[model samples]
Target: MHAISVRRVRRSLPRAALALVLAALGAALGPGAAPAAAAGHAEECSTEAGPYQKTVERHLKLTVDGVQSAADCAAIRTLQTRHGMEPATGRAGPETWRIVQYERAVADPSALTGCPHGTRLIVCVDLHRQLLWVWDGDHVATGPVPIRTGKSGYATRTGEHRIYERVEKQWSELYEGPMPFSQFFDGGQALHASYRNIWEEPGSHGCVNLRYDDAKRLWQGLRLNDPVYVWGTRGP
Candidate 1:
């Protein structure tokens, strides 16, 4: 198996200053957690539709300001509803802006690639862009991952560590759904994937999350000795 290496995005996960939830327990959900949906076919940021839906919503919330028009409010509701977030007071006040701030956290990916199956070597995930990158030497494959991070006020914890272990089908009273728990340094953070609404959002509890498919791909490829780099939210 080829060894995949990478220089992760310089940014780290969120510290106490503004921590958000990247991935964790599904918590209180009755039976099963929502499955990880397709990313490309689903919603995204845009003024059009489909994968661009999230982008459209973000644009409406941030760019189009002023009175609470039915369309504007509906857009806000769509954003809040999809992410399992609370509605913006039904009035689109400060909470709306808060969502916008978190939405802006996503940054361009640094690098990514995948190794052969037998290698089972190291894997790296960056919390900043919500992207899961698997590397084999200098080559890697990056999948656009979505997560449910803490809202405006709260942010996910961030730091640097190596991946030593992983758990599958882990249930949680804190998470919104079933998640794969990853073992880092603190035993507090994880590297599971998350789906925010129909579109992918940079939201999570306090873990460095990945898309279910991306995690699955990495899960099968990663070995205990692989490297894992994490830090705070991406900067402006």
Candidate 2:
């Protein structure tokens, strides 16, 4: 019985040591250790070819073959991560392709010619491209970022408007949804952050939905009474 007890202690020593080591490492790494590890694991590229593989490859200037190569995955994944797209699995999916189109549109927001330029900061929403940019007179101060506006019946109001309300965290009783960084520019419609995928269809109820990060940054930059210019029509 004594020998058996000794053997059990010996067997547990290694596990105890491992637990100590892991605890020390966790302490050193801080709270983000688990997520960082998971993110690193998630960074592994997907092997299957996505539906828009060839289109994404062409846009990224990669080989136009519709195959999912390691190199292709890395490049596509980089763009996806940079733009805060989800999964970021290096898959050339619809979301990835949409971001590519958005980047192209951002390259020349001036071409839209609808956003008025002046010294005052103006939040410009181009429904045609589903993009928003902050124009500080002739030059863009921020954005040209992707946005999700209202759907068919609940179209985002066009023409000029001003941000009359700014709520850091808002809950809408009308829709029973949380609107973070809500910047009301027109009536019930506002520019706010959405937890849902910005690309999700049917769309917001007349609010201009932005990514969490984008909406936070925008909230920080603008104040009450800032002008918001919305134009064109929502693209299919």
Candidate 3:
């Protein structure tokens, strides 16, 4: 009997020590340091909520519940649908978040940091954000248009440039393709309309491709010698 009691105490000691260690770890990591599954779920909800929280409250004119409730998710789905985003299944992911970020940046005047100071009627393209905006002094004339810039090997050049030539319908001699409303700013590279889906990944060969309507708008607004600023790098 004495031997059996001693063995039981030894077994219980390990269990008690494990519990104490777990408690200490939990305390160090804080309340958010839940079990793995619980922590993962929390992180997912947080990622889904981050980009659209303010957008939902301010622009979508809906309630923001940190994406914790069904109603909040539904609202986000509706917004995504309106914006033409695919798989609008009330689940916010990277692509959906990107669109939200772009919209928010367009609406915020302070976000136009790429536009040079004292320059009026400028074409600003943020490669990292993948957005284009036509700035007329303090006002935005016509953009926040989604654009596809040069892909990996042929990254678009940054810094200030000017539209040196404009052609309503230009043919790409190098690629033997149609480049409508071509506005050349950097060598053969131009800003033009591409029939391919601009939102689709792995963008242009070196030119900045805009949607048909946006290209038309830009063609009408931009003039020769107007500053065209392209900045930032395409993010991974």
Candidate 1, superposed: residue stretches over 4 Å from native: 1-122, 141-157, 173-177, 181-185, 195-202, 232-236
Residue 224 in model 1: shift from native, Å? Answer: 1.7
lDDT of 3 by residue, 54-167 (tens): 545445666654553566666667766677654455555545555766788767867767666454788888888788888787788877877878877878888899998888
List runs of model 2 lying over 4 Å from the truth. 1-55, 65-74, 88-93, 105-113, 199-202
lDDT, candidate 2, 64-146, per-residue tens? 98999999999999998787665578988767766876888677664546788777789989887788888887777888778
Q: lDDT score, residue 9, model 3?
A: 9
| Residue 150 Cα positional deviation in candidate 3, in Å, after optimal superposition | 1.5
Best by lDDT: 2
Alpha-carbon TM-score of each model against the true structure: 0.43, 0.65, 0.64
lDDT tens digits, residues 1-236, model 1? Answer: 11111112214442222222212222333346622432223233223223233444555645443444456556666766654453222344433444444454334333232223234333444444343445555444443344333334445555445665566665444443555534343344556544323122334445555545656766666656566554445321
Model 1 TM-score on a 0 to 1 scale: 0.43
Whose TM-score is higher: candidate 2's or candidate 3's? Answer: 2
C-alpha local distance difference test of each model: 0.43, 0.76, 0.68
What CA RMSD would candidate 1 show?
Answer: 14.1
- The deviation in Å at residue 132 for candidate 1 is 2.5
